[model samples]
Target: MLAKIIQEGLLNHGFHILETRTIQYGTQIRLLEGAIINVYRTPKVLVQGKSISASPEQLRKNLEYVLPTRITVWNLM
Candidate 1:
């Protein structure tokens, strides 16, 4: 459910979906710009990639649209 919403949101934001795989826990979506989105069944989403931080405004907006009010950002540097 969440995965489908995210896929549609990203696509509407002009992001090209490179690949999609159903993992053991949930769905993994790979984007052309090197961004990987992992939507887990536990209502937790893990977004990784250098491009994510520097992505366009619309991309960020799409993320915010799906995210809950409480968000935790970790600087995995």
Candidate 2:
């Protein structure tokens, strides 16, 4: 869906999109230093390293899994 949006946006701006694809997963993953590609993050990845910011979804999922019930309950909404 995001790729389609991006491609359509590019086409609207007179740019061409050579390809489009989508990836769905059920596990959390992080981006490395040089790899700048990301589709989505899952709900099972733990984040405790220095470069903790991967994506909002990944961060929220981890927080909900590790945090106390009080904190997790609010963000879940």
Candidate 3:
């Protein structure tokens, strides 16, 4: 799954992961230095004040999600 790929990717990049735990919504990876990453099992996205929630498989197809060391977000139209 994409989540596992990201987990491995972060591990390869020298991220000190404090914990990997599952909450009610999804899995959360706690890193050192008070940073946390959430890979939602079911991602809920809000676009233009509308809530859109879906399963991982569904979101994977409809969304293009990425995680990088530097934050860069683009609103694709």
**Candidate 2, which segments miss by more than 4 Å at Cα?**
23-38, 41-77
Q: Any runs in candidate 1 off by more than 4 Å, and if so which?
A: 52-77
Error of 1 at 31 (Å): 0.5
| The best candidate in terms of lDDT | 1
> How much lDDT does candidate 2 score?
0.33
Quick one: RMSD of model 3?
Answer: 11.7
Supply candidate 1's per-residue lDDT for 25.
90
The root-mean-square deviation over C-alpha atoms between each candidate and the true structure, in angstroms, is 3.6, 11.9, 11.7
Q: After TM-score superposition, what is the CA distance of residue 3 in candidate 3 from its true location, in Å?
A: 2.3
Candidate 1 lDDT tens digits, 7-73 = 8877886778999999989898887766677788887777765464455554545556644435323
**Candidate scoring better on lDDT of 1 and 2:** 1
Instruction: Give the TM-score comparing model 2 with the true structure, all chains together.
Output: 0.27
Candidate 2 lDDT tens digits, 20-69: 33435422222231111223333222223222334545544533443333
Q: Model 2 clash pairs?
A: none
lDDT of every predicted structure (CA atoms) = 0.68, 0.33, 0.47
Stretches > 4 Å off in candidate 3: 43-77
What lDDT is obtained when candidate 3 is compared to the true structure? 0.47
**TM-score per candidate, chains pooled:** 0.70, 0.27, 0.52
Better of 2 and 3 by TM-score: 3
Residue pairs clashing, model 1: none
